[model samples]
Target: MNVTGWQRDALLAVAEVVVLAVILVMALLGNGLVLVVLLRRRRHHNPLHLFMLNLCLADLVVALFQVLPQLVWDAKGRFPGPDFLCRLVKYLQVLGMFASSYMIVAMTVDRHYAICCPLQAHRSGATQRWNTFILLAWGLSLLLSLPQVFIFSRSEVAPGVYECWGNFAESWGLKAYVTWMTLAVFILPVVIITVCQPGPAASSAFCCPLPKAPTARGGEVSAAMSKTVRMTLVIVLVYSLCWAPFFSVQLWAAWDPDPPQNGAVFTLLMLLASLNSCTNPWIYSAFSSIQLYGKLINILCLVCLIQTLYFILYM
Candidate 1:
């Protein structure tokens, strides 16, 4: 069947909304499950699990406030709320992104110290200190996102169609801001994670199989630490791949304000970036045990179904 340009555009818009909605659902459910399971488990107060909880919380913030507003704007073609609400939404969204990135970095650093420098890790990573790390991560994220409060404003895109947009005074300012954000939130964190990854011998510090077994302590600890290193490395890889396109496009838009229109492509890129929030839980599940691996595989199959449907109907 053939479709006209308008029809095709309408389909694409619908696909964007549906895809974003699916992402929100998956992110909420998967991260919520992580929170719930960790909270209900007997060892919930441990530093490592608490750090995972922080990551889940950050992903939830992105799903609920960040992606949800974008989804609404895409579906409605305008900001549905007042100027103040728009500013708040934009601020929260950026804060969530910063928080998620920093949370991952903190996780990497914590593991690196724990595995590579046991005595130092024991001294520096006490319960109070871990609390301070969590606090500092959230505090710095909010502080860094403060500029969004001043930079975003509700602007009229068409006659009576208001949308939230950057209110930078100059093009250079916008470019600089986006460049800094890209570096701080994406590039620098990935580099830090890469550098902090433990080598094979360091893995022996904290190895244990995901499943409980009466195995030799040394071998188990080595295997577990190796898996942990692999898992975090994979996370950083996925995060970079998912976010690079969106940041690249941002830099391009900053360079050329009147860039050529490719709305569908932009939507696809945004969807890929949002998928990062939905992936961490699945990554954890994959490295955990056979049971979780099976369940995560099923979830992945469903996600593939949704992506296929969107491409078939809209592209």
Candidate 2:
């Protein structure tokens, strides 16, 4: 049977709603637990933990403020946005995305310090130093996104919700956003992630210490560092897995406004790309499951992902 793009999109949008609903429930529980856990402990506070709490909260806002509204728009089959409203949507989205990325970087740094430099992690008020760095992360993300707020608004084009993002080319209205987003979100972060990759290895080389003088705690430290390394690597990998396809698909869509019309494949790509937001909590819980709570939530999140992907893959 021949199906129109709108027809297919309608089906997919329904599926998206289902998935978003499931994710909202899980994220609320998972992030709510995060808030409880972080807030409960006053004695063992650390900067990384604080950042994670903020991360969960930010992700929660995104689901509520941006995702829910977009879903409503999709259901109504209309953009339903005035220009100022569009700008507000754009701001919420950009802020959420930037905050998430920066939080990942911050978490990686925390792991780097804790596992790689155990002595430094403890010595000379090192924890406080990293806390300052975390503040800088929040600050930089906010500062970087300031220019895009003014440039982002709704377009009066087709009958779909269109919020302005960065202009990759010479579109002046979109230029400032394009420049900053490219540098901060894509270019600089990826480059820094790649270059700093060697840091953990180098730290291990120095910290592992030869068996010629084995201390009792040496093995324990090595194992801890190893797990920490694996965790950080997964964090980066997950970030890339989710965002790369999105950026690629989005770039193409911007160049060719009819990308979803190019075929079901492009539409599929968009569907899969949006799944990342729903996937973040899972990634965090994957190996970091310290309690039975993590195990249950991880499994539940996985089931949600599989079910969410079913309509797209099977249909």
- Per-residue lDDT for 51-158 in model 1, tens only? 878998999999999989989988996788888998899899999899999988888887787666655556665687677778888998999999898988889777
Worst 10 residues of 2 by lDDT: 165-174
Candidate 1 residue 292 Cα shift, in angstroms, is 5.0
Largest lDDT belongs to which candidate? 1
- Pairs clashing within candidate 2: 166-178
Q: What is the clash count for each candidate, in the order shown?
A: 2, 1
lDDT of 2 by residue, 231-283 (tens): 66776786788677756666665555356644545655554434555555555
Instruction: Please list the residue runs of candidate 1 whose C-alpha ends up more than 4 Å from where it truly belongs after superposition.
Output: 1-5, 42-45, 200-216, 289-315
Q: What lDDT score is found at residue 26 in candidate 1? A: 88
